[model samples]
Target chain A: MNKKYYRWLILILALLVLTFGAGIISLLSGEMDIPWHTLPDILVQKEGIQYSIVTQIRWPRIVLAFSVGGALSLTGAILQGIYRNPLVEPYTLGISGGAALGIALVVVLGLHLSMGSYMLPLAGFIGSIVTIFLVYTLSFRRGGININRMLLIGVMISFVASSMMMFLMAITSSENLHGIVFWMMGSLDEPNALLIDIMLYASLAGLFISYLFARPLNALRLGEEKARHLGIHSTITLRILFVVASLLTGICVAVTGIIGFVGLIIPHIVRLVIGSDYRILLISSFLGGSFFLIVSDIIARTVIAPNELPIGVITGLAGGLIFIVVLTRANVQSKIS
Target chain B: MAVYLNIQQLVCGYNLGFQLKGIDLKIEKGAFAGIIGPNGSGKSTLFKAISGDLNIQSGLIEMNNKKLSSFSLREKALKMAVVSQFNEVLDVTVEDYVLMGRMPYRRNFQFFETKEDLIIARKYMRLTNVYQYKDHLMTELSGGEQQLAAIARALTQEPELLLLDEPTAHLDISHQVQILNLIQHLNEEMGLTVLIIIHDLNMAGEYCNHLVMMNDGNIHQHGNPHEVLTYQNIETVYNTVVIVRENPVSGKPVVFPVSEKTFKKTTNTSS
Candidate 1:
């Protein structure tokens, strides 16, 4: 590979290594330290000293960290491609607010769907999809959907949804309020495998769908008129984008409230490394996002020690720092575009 | 040459108002035709109507032997390619951007261009003398290079009818001559029925087989360059007196803009 290619590869690989390394650190050193050698025995065997401290609790959280990391980054990458706006976040379609409203209302209502385990994420998923469909139909017309109108309508829907959440929060019992508040803060340690599984599956499904759209998304980078003139139906492409991205945002948001900026920053960082080609950008963004989120999750766990910090705070902080580094690092005005 | 397109009682305009009034014209197949006029004379407007970019307000258009609407967009694209104004798209490679012309023909489910498509794209890119820059970022190229790539893109479509809007709009002298000569070669070798909207009267005189003069959206005259581009036609249509002479090398009609003193002196004495 040439210098440019090598640089990006090195950075992406380094990020991946950091992600895995951080997860390992989080797994081994959290609260109770299980010796590194005994960790394997806990994972593989039924007869060995049961290191439940390492395997039972930490391992699942580690997997959740990796999966959620990948999911958040992929959602951001796909959103950037469809919107053709580098600054666009995962919630451009109002899925986060919609899901937030659903989850918040459910929490405030004292619904113990965690008993079923699938019900909470399902509610969030359904809410996001419904809102996405509503936004798309409102913006779509005889042929194509207008991006500005879609964004505006989504934000409008988000505002209304936020108000509804607040209104529901106003009347909820003080006891349930604590859980709802923590959930809204966004967390990685849901301690519920079924909910995490649903999100993991949804994220994987969304990623697969995004890969299928790689070629069309590249054409769309030239803007919709050119994309349409090139024989790809702009309307249909936008619809698929809406639904797949909605599924991703819905599932992620349902599981972990609202984690901002991962979607906006990850794709741009990938694009800077891998030019504007959607094929490369999409994959790299997925990797980078997964790595970024994993690393952030580790920091969230370690920085507060016994006290847990919201996953969103870590992401927002990392995203802010990455954005500044990306902007200032290169002669970006020329190389960036 | 037989008539390739016949437009009758056509009115073309946007929602603001009618730009092109009622018009009637016929373009012969394999003709290198140029429509020349001053700005706001509806030259581009007329072409848009003919190309179906703007809906014909009131008219019947017959292309080849069928009504205009009978042919689908694919069929029309196969017959015609439009090289619009020299717009810039510097993000893509020169080759892929050209391959987009084949979009009107190919399937759209994210398949890369077939080998045949690649060969065609390469061939046209080479023909336009932009093959060396096939992998180059479009933004890195000069203005002339971009225009040439756009022409290559239009050619890659392999259309029978080539409609260009001021293909050499802002190019320097060498680039202008290069585009005109390249277009002339395409017309001669491929028998491509070329219709270009150009403002350069001298370039049109030398390159076009037939010259069409438009004034206020209606054809003022149309014939072989020698017959139609007369001093009287120039004076009446452009409201300017001009001397028309044959070029010594090409033996084509060339116009020389006349000063007002000469026009006034001649009109006063001769009238």
Candidate 2:
């Protein structure tokens, strides 16, 4: 038992170190090539072009990436525990589509121009909230929420939301269409410090709240009936966890447009490495996601150097390839053992 | 002995038309009782109502002189632990799985199992003979082993009443005997109240001190093995001709189904 605990500690420490390294690399290797050795001096000086660029441009994006990635992945792990299906993620419930549609509608109507830039994220947040409310209410029966019905409803709503988004795209002007598509692809270029701070703090708070229910989440792995037999109020647990996961996903989508695959892939990778014990799965997935997104962001900016690609493009390509490789190796290793 | 579990005119069912209509029963403290009946006989529904899985439409279920509905889920879990028929074999280790039984005892905001919880879990794991497979994932264990693991987890709950629904349905004969023996030991030595839903009449007769014969959502008979396992009751309830005879060694009743051919041959020869 002690050995197992120690092993988890080592794995978590390794992830922390890796995340720190990814953060440093992200800070140093943006469009302006700041040298690694000069980082400490630049921190002390605080007045050069490099200092301003690091603090203003790259640092906020890095913070945004960590929180968004961590929140999405954490929500994925929680939702999977709730639904008991591995294929579930924040986006599986049409949260991203809803947020994207909201942003598209706002851009086409030129709401951001009139109301200010905050209108974009506000619309996105409202849109996701509305979608989750619809899904939650529609799947609710006489007294309890049916998980299978919720998943089916979520999928159908996703289809509906995407079709609606496409219709909006069809009627909008080309300039507005460009804005909509760019936002849909996702980016971590939010310049608002307050929003970044909120995301960071909210993600951390989500992580802490999730830890309180780690044991319940583990109980749920035995199925809801057995979980209830073990003394968990499965219905209440499901409801609270559903709302928490959707809200986190809503906030993430509202803030970052839609960064796909981190939520889906990070948890799978972390579970493969560490066991399915939610106490560790939740934290590890959060850190692993932050590490993955930071690295993906680094690649997104540097691969094209002057012309930056959207972070979602890099995340999908890199995250998918890495997941495939990890899965293949895990399959082969299981066969060998 | 005091009545440990009392049900008065219980009426409950799923929305699919199956219902347990106005059922009343009582189980004495520390009694090894079995509920036996055919499929769709509301055996599972009755069990569900008692376990708080199904909403009781009307009537009262009291445990230890307190209404069952008054107890919170955690309090109910502290009083009774259920070993269900089917459980998803997850990727969790047996030790971890067994430790889940300690959930009811967990304090608010408790993240990990306490030392006391671990000791209790290990005790039950040893009792059920699953300690050797503690580190193995539940998916890796055989069906019988998994069932034993499930029992170990239930024992870890330290419940006063242990409820099992068809625990041995999927096990081999030897495994079935092994599990029943363990349950009997828990009942006899620890004075745990056991109410099991069993399909095997012979096993029920062998192990249970009292039997409740259920037919069409109501109790057909409730008494000692000798009185409840009679061939007439079996034939009437199960819709089959069965021969009930005494076991030479244990002196308990044993049932033998009389097939159509044997019945016909016996009728013709007698004529």
Error of 2 at A53 (Å): 1.7
Candidate 2 overall Cα lDDT vs. reference?
Answer: 0.91
Top-lDDT structure, candidate number? 2
The TM-scores that each candidate's chain B achieves against the reference are 0.93, 0.98
Q: What share of the true interface contacts does each candidate keep?
A: 0.15, 0.85
For residues A212-318, could you state the per-residue lDDT of candidate 1 as single tens digits?
A: 77777776766665554344556677888877777777778877777777878887777665677665676677767777777777677778788778888988887
Residue-wise C-alpha lDDT for candidate 2, range B7-59, written one tens digit per residue: 99999998779888899899999999999999988899999999998999999
B5-73 in candidate 1: lDDT tens per residue? 888888878778657888888888898999987777789888887776667878888889788878776
Best by TM-score: 2
RMSD of each: 4.5, 1.7
In model 1, the clashing pairs are: A69-A290, A70-A290, B90-B139
Q: Candidate 2: what's its TM-score on chain B?
A: 0.98
Off by over 4 Å in 1: A1-29, A32-40, A46-72, A104-123, A142-145, A163-181, B1-29, B37-79, B86-88, B99-119, B211-221, B226-248, B251-271
What residue pairs clash in candidate 2, if any at all?
none
